[model samples]
Target chain A: MSDQTENEESPLAGEAYTLTSEPKLIDGRRVLGVVPGKPSTGESKDLIDEDAVMVWPHLLVRHAVAALAVMLLVLLLALLFDAPLREIANPNLTPNPEKAPWYFAALQELLAHFHPLVAGILVPTGILFGLAALPYLDRNAYLKPRHRKVAITAFTAFLGIWIILTLVGFAFRGPNWGWVWPWNEWYGEL
Target chain B: MKVMDRVRHSMMGRSFFRAPDRVTTRDVAAGHWANFFLHIYPVKMRRKEISFRYSWYLGAISTVLFGSLVASGVYLMFFYVPSPANAYGDIINLETQVAFGQYIRNVHRWSAHLMVLAVSFHMARVFYRGAYKSPREFNWVIGVVLLLLTLLLSFTGYLLPWDQLAYWAVTVGTGMATYVPFIGDRVSEILLGGPAVGASTLIRFYVLHVALLPAVLVVVLAVHLWRWRKDSMLDMERSEP
Candidate 1:
């Protein structure tokens, strides 16, 4: 069927063309006259095929370097700063500020303003479910951010707000969960 | 290179490798396919996909940090016990008495913090790159699971030190759980194994940090990587045309 279409479209349709030698078989198909020009699909398709590369050395080498770099950073950190060890845990005496880990600082900050149910349970659950549902929710098939304005905007806004809240909860808040300059009165713990 | 070639031709190497020497692209691909460690990786990827800007290698960095944690954590576990009386004392003894204990503990601490950062960055990178599209959607979900697991792992390990920071931080962290309408108390009870963060809580968090969560993360991470390898070659962007 493709051959029929090609023959009909060919400029040499009505002209008599002869093979220089006996017709050879290629890939179980009778050899037609070899066209000595670019493929109909164009050069970009071939370039796309060339874009793929073996992962053995190409990717593995990069991964190895990354691994080494991270290891070195960890080592430097370990050497420079000792892991903080405060007084032994005293359950009867609670710390004043009573902060959570840095990662959960955003939720902790939210808890300061909102009800525990809203800030703790509902918000975190909503975020998790929303993240898991993102691909299905935003059905736009475009890969570029410019083509995906809504998703990009929503994510960036969430990211920015979360980061700010985390910084506030981790560093800015002091005793009684009151706002304080981090440099003056540092309450942040590892 | 010559030495590697000679080894490849050796009888022992031939028996071990089960593939021809890496002379051509096909040979390299065959060798990659035959290796157990490389099973998690696709044999080939788009050149752009492998570049530094594409991923910033955050996933790789996170995995390496996990590896560092496992190594350093196991070493620390040898000198410590999970009890109210001994936990803090053990840490003190380990840091002062045992050789390289302080260094190893520091490595574990820093690695845990870095792992959290790397994993979160990985998720954000994946989001901005629109890497969570159709064929890769499930992998993205798996990634979310990983992020949660990373947080859980760090939180659980935080209590193992038995310091004041660990105690109060965990208390504040777990205190939020009681806000859940139903089964809130039950969840907190199950997690602490008692009314409050006591000996029972210490042991519970220890077991979770050292044993259960790591096992689950390993399994989930395996599935995540397997799916990644399977979907690596898919042209999600081009499929529309």
Candidate 2:
């Protein structure tokens, strides 16, 4: 009897506002009508309002302008500087302390410290796998900075390590892959 | 809407060239809807998705860099020969003789470097924003793949110049592959086509750099963008500071 009163008072007021077992007649017709449930806070789809501004002149225009700006910057940089093209590759005359491109400099630095397999292959593969695994490992939904303290810390550490290693490769390593400060005369001689 | 209207009224609009009456918002939506390529992006999006600070537009910058690289690379290729004997000489000729050739090469090189950086920064931004949660997880995985592809693209292109920088960098780069346990030597051999970087390696890298990798990146990027549209920027309701 209490259930009936509750149903009568509020058609959609509680957590279990699913359809009741008792069928009801509406305008002389029996119906399995909806007893709408209270909105679920956990559901993101319900919270998002689909009505949004159109993409044209908003999204598309901004994207176009940003791309154009990038192109212009590239053009300016291209005109101001020349791409380094050293004497045609002489395999017989290897440059001392030869370096891989800057992007790979960190991996090369890693190779300097650990076994090649560990530094070059294992660590890189691990990093990639870890990145792919991030979403699965941390399933918390809140985007607030306070809620994600640990994740933010771990990522910052990873980024800091990479930057440090890259700097070590770029300015520290010299001839015969030996350590030499960038300010030293021998550093530029290479 | 008003600006679009004036443009439609003017002679410069594409729709105006065809039919003056076909430039309304409904027509624009219909146009995007009917087209296969354009349909990947919805005609409407939450305004916050485009806000400058929301994403810092790093992804867009990376895409632009990639476009610049492709354009400059294709232009450079016209005067380049993949063979060992002619490759270095071809590069010399390109710089010394060809019009805008040096500029094009510069742009390609810089763009490649910039793309790698931009992609990294974009990933970092995504992570910092906690945008990888919930239904957006798979998209994050795809983003990782794209990042790997970007690195591979940069590495493979490093060899094409056939210069000292190109030769030794790739040699050292490929030599790292040889440290991978059982199949290490086999991997290096396959990559270089021999015990060392040579003609086979150059041609192989050329093919991968120019054809295979870019094609794969494009397909994966398509899926990334499509999924982004499907997911529509993680929890925009909670986006406010």
Candidate 3:
């Protein structure tokens, strides 16, 4: 099929640049090399296969480096920061301003301003559906950042909002979940 | 002299991992095929696929972080009990008395956080690269599910320590489930096993955290990897000759 397409695309295939009789293996798959020059009578082939590296050493070495770096970082973190374990649970006594885990802090923040149904259920579900439907919605084959202007802009905005909300929840919320300035004494309630 | 060198190489290789002194075509093919782990990978990859500048290796790092979390979690579990009566005390005993227990807990906590970040960033990386298009779409969806699983795993485990922090944090977190309109109360009740976060909640969270969620994640991850290998890296598709 490819040979037919190549031949059809090239009007002067036999006259301009003849096909090489020799077939070669590329990335373990057999491929026909096209000799793009003056037509040759003899069977001399020029390999036009894309250059690639064996996964064994090339990709494996990088994977090894990544593994080592992650291990070292985790070790350093474990040594430096002990996991937080607060006072034992007491049903009668609640922390002045209870908070969710940091990752959910953004959603908590959203709940502070918007209705829980909208903030917690609707928005998150929308985001997930949006993510899942992205490939189908945007069928453009190009990957360059400039070509995907709208996607890049919208995603960046979403990330910015997420970070801002998380920051507000993490550091700004205080007693009764009121918005407190970071430098204020009420922040100590956290 | 060369024969003596070959003998020395064989002797040294026998002491360690056995391998030929020089790599050949057979060695390259066998390197992937003969090894259980390496067999997941294709023998040869496009130069662009291995380029760090493109991927920054976020997905691989996320997998490593997840592995670390599981290892550290299991180690910590040896010193932990899920019951509300002993959960906090067990954590304290583990930290102060058990050797490397604090380290294990810390690694598990930090790695969990890192895995969340890594997985989220990996999704972003795939999105920006437009790797989710065409044949790769389902794998992208699988990745999204994995991301959700990572978050749920982290959230469920958040209640394991049974500290005031864990109890109340979970209270606030699960309270969000009550906003689902009609089924909201039922969802919250089901999660807590009642109207509140109590012993039932802790045990439920513990079971889901350690056994159920991790098992699901592993099964889904296998699918993710199978698709990744079968489809090859997206760079192969994007790169021009």
Candidate 4:
């Protein structure tokens, strides 16, 4: 969510009650926070109030660092290799039976038989359009697996099909663009 | 009532098994430091709701795969020359000659396919969650543009091989482009460089696959991310602290 949403959601909460969320020393000396929700001994810093929020900075930092590390490694590699660029493209040799990179070969294979609008343009567009509209679709507030069975199952089925089709496409379809209709080929990728 | 029972006894009933240690009342409480940002929405009405389901992870995971593509793609670039004569040979050499060349190509190829799936799945997850409610409408549009960019990247990269597959695939793909009215032919001409996918086409795709498209994508992605941050993260239960 964005900051705008935050303001909209918290119009009254911030003003509902005044808590010494942040305590400061008075008389320019030191002000001990009289936290209404604190451990009686004050030795343990555990918070006890529903009004208090606890955040794990380390967790967010971990995510941020992981993202940064991966991206940096990619950038460095990119600087080193410069990706392969082929020679002059030949149009006369049309039907060059242009297969997509091995990765996209399946879709290219699908496009090989299906129309571009359907395989290349239409279906993919629909999927994206569908994604952007998700917030309005599944609004159930349950985070547990039991509450999200449909979501989990649907995602798994989708990935399963894609990966399975890809492996199957790679296996049955030889380098020459051949294909097979067997489930065994869905076992793995090269 | 105990918080555990409160959670376990909700309309959907709490999921006791999902990170039980971390699901303390504080995790869902209002106003906390560090993670105050997550509480962008009111919590009382949240009712144990998830943000966009675990499906939301698809987007983050897709971003990871995209990162992998950019890496391996760059590595493949080192030995690849944009000339038609050398393109195929270079690919062969990368496979048979260069160190880790085969691995790089394999990873690049696989991740490219993976990204396509991830992007599509990510979109699907978003749609399923209806996270596009009220104020978040425009980001959805931005997402659509990003999807187009992803496909365009995939399409343009298809011709970089200069093999039978590259030549024929691009030929068929661009042939469709030529059908557009008005400046269709011109557009195809611009795409192929000199009427067809030749040396010019190779260079065109080279420029596009590497420089042009990435540049555009980066800008758009930055905006998309900025919007996400500005729009508040899609958190479940508006959990803060």
Candidate 5:
């Protein structure tokens, strides 16, 4: 039959103007039917082949190797060295430096510097809370790392500064309340 | 077969999912360095790639540190008791005997320090990236709670060693907690388990360090992670630096 004749005699000629034609995936519970004209190409490939993707091997490689590497080293070291456990609870005697585990020494240092609420309770608490709350706060539609350069740069700089200051505290300063600088210390007692 | 050759490919839906079947950082990491090193489990961020930078690695570093702590912590647990009465002595024993315990202790100690720093850096990364906007607001809140829990975990862990540093630090810490108006004294007592860092306080801190806080942080961290999956990673493709 001619195309025009078929069109004229179509099942419902009254609905001819409203009729349209296209194909889409059969996203039924049982099967996802394919849409017509969307020839196989580009990034749409992963959706077409479910069987191959189900065994997502890359994810396993990323998580498995890095995690396992660290664990093994620590375990071997634990086996090799005995961790220091302090003496039985004595309510009395105090160690000389009275130093905190190195990390808290900064807070110990800060607690030394400011009120406990600010250093111990508030600031650290606020920062941590602020950190966890971050994803909820900034909802802009910038996905690629490069697109959000401001955020990236800021984060990078902050991290750099933080690390520098932390190391400075651990390395240059003593357990004393004194805040020392190179020239300042040379001129002072030491 | 290459992912591009498949039939259902779409060009516009890049934001929907992390174009599965594409070459990931893990694939490259494996291809590049797979030949060497220990067993490295590359736990790919299940969400979209937030950024392609070194800073992104900070969160991963924290995970590594936590893993270090858990492993060493378990070993230390073998000989250490949590009682305020026996806590200090156990520390001494681990230091003196049990074979190479000192290194384990140092790693645990240093990693705790590193975890705080790493988490802080990871937070800063999220913030400047504007990754905290809109859909991610709840996750940000979760991150904040996790942050507090991390600090609390660190604080509680401090007293377990029971050395002078532990004694005085907690002394000062709990002492400071009492500054709150009505609850100052009450809170201090609660934290101290009586009035000062004594038997009750030691046991309290031990339970907190070994049990309570970790559970909370892990749960929160899980949520924090799951939300990332939901909102997708906040990789802003516009900014540079």
Candidate 6:
């Protein structure tokens, strides 16, 4: 009781408020009495509204599940498929199609259409720089899709074109980088 | 649960954990803070951020794939010698003679391919979520660098099998470097370590794949996660308004 009264009378008493009858320490600050109504500032309210949850069981458990799921996927894939291994590399004998890895398929497709400068050098450099500069270039404060139409549209368009190009290069192209029906003759290598 | 709690409360456990029993939120937070592994994560995050839809956990998926790659890559390394003479034979011998070599190689191959997909998907997801805004902008740049590194690592590893696919693919791939304006030839030569892909190129790619690039990625990834932790609690929506 004496400690409670002392806390209430102390210079820091106005900041120290209790939710219980007994005086207690929270974060090393003594609690006196509960202040009625809302916090003085909106900042505190916003923080409360954030609904912050502990990362331990909450986020960690989710991450663990995600990790396990991917591991299982890799394990299953390893079981089902054998990684491709062709004959020994010979400089003189290039494969008819001579494909880059699938991830670079888009660039290879572009190289088929455009000059080496445009497809090979400039386009890749532009894409990387553009991606890196995205946050700064599109300084729009709004987060919702409706609020940021132009950025979303532009990005989606690029992504679509890139995906299409990748598909063309990876599966739809045959010898001499010519178009082929993948269903008829599969040239894709993984 | 009881046995676990008892262990947690024991002197050795207490010393290891550097926190009391997890009876309260404070205790949990304390334990998290004390943990070296958990240091990468924030103590708290908004409820929405933890939901699967918010992130699709693509970043976590990419990381796990990378881990799988690292494990399988190390195993492959034990059997591989980075030379045209030994490289192709080693892969064949590994697939036939070595225990689980084919499976581990498959794991590495699939994980590499999946990692490329996951990282790219993560970028798209981040863009859609507008997660690169303001305070998170630099992390986005770091992510781009990571994406480039991932591609490079994959491309380098592609050549290790010394198969016809690898040889021609790299020939075509490095051939593109010759389009880089005035310095084109120089860049191509530096990358190939010769007029064409040969012994030097294999050794060069091997070192970069195993040592240099992975080291850079790990360091950059550490910074990326650290920044993520620091910015995790920021209310970007409110801050903008």
Model number with the top lDDT: 6
Candidate 5's C-alpha runs over 4 A off are A1-55, A72-102, A105-122, A125-176, A181-190, B1-61, B64-68, B95-107, B233-241
Q: Give the DockQ-based CAPRI class for model 1.
A: acceptable
Give RMSD (Å) of candidate 1 vs. truth: 8.4
Best by DockQ: 6
Q: What residue runs in model 4 are displaced by over 4 Å at the alpha carbon?
A: A1-190, B1-56, B233-241
> Model 5 over residues A1-190: C-alpha lDDT tens digits?
1321222233233433232422111211111232224334642545321121211254445445655655565556546644444444455765433444444445555666687767667765555555554454444467566676765675567556556655444444543645556445421110
The C-alpha lDDT values of all candidates are: 0.89, 0.81, 0.80, 0.59, 0.58, 0.90
Using alpha carbons, what is the TM-score of model 1? 0.89
lDDT of 1 by residue, A162-184 (tens): 99999999999999999999889
lDDT of 3 by residue, B97-169 (tens): 9998888988998899889989988988888887787778889989989999999999999899998888888
After superposing candidate 1, which stretches have Cα over 4 Å from the reference?
A: A1-50
Fraction of reference contacts reproduced per prediction? Answer: 0.81, 0.79, 0.76, 0.17, 0.25, 0.84
DockQ pick, better of 1 and 5: 1
Q: Name the weakest run of 10 consecutive residues (lDDT summed) in model 2 chain B.
A: B14-23
Q: What TM-score does structure 3 among the candidates reach?
A: 0.82
Candidate 4 yields a Cα-based lDDT of 0.59
lDDT by residue (tens digit), candidate 2, A87-188: 888879989888988877889889988999898999999999999999999877778788879888889999999998887887788887788877773432
Backbone clash numbers for all candidates listed = 0, 0, 0, 47, 73, 1
Better of 1 and 4 by DockQ: 1
lDDT of 5 by residue, B42-141 (tens): 2233333422352355556667777777877788888888775676777777778878677778778766766786777676766665656665677767
Q: Which pairs of residues collide in model 1? A: none
Residues B1-241 of candidate 1 have per-residue lDDT tens digits of: 7688778879988988889466445667889999999989999999889999999999989999999999999999999999999999999998999999999999999999999999999999999999998878889999999999999999999999899999999999898888789899998898888878999999999999999999999999999989989988888767652
Task: Give TM per candidate.
Answer: 0.89, 0.81, 0.82, 0.57, 0.61, 0.89
Off by over 4 Å in 6: A1-49
What interface-residue Cα RMSD does candidate 1 give after superposition?
Answer: 4.6
DockQ per model, Cα: 0.38, 0.32, 0.37, 0.11, 0.14, 0.47
Q: What digit string (tens of lDDT, one per residue) describes model 4 on residues B61-165? A: 567777787887889899999987788888988878999887687667656655776777766666555454445667777777887788889878877777665
True contacts kept of 3: 0.76
Model 2 regions lying over 4 Å from their true place:
A1-51, A183-190, B1-27, B35-37, B233-241
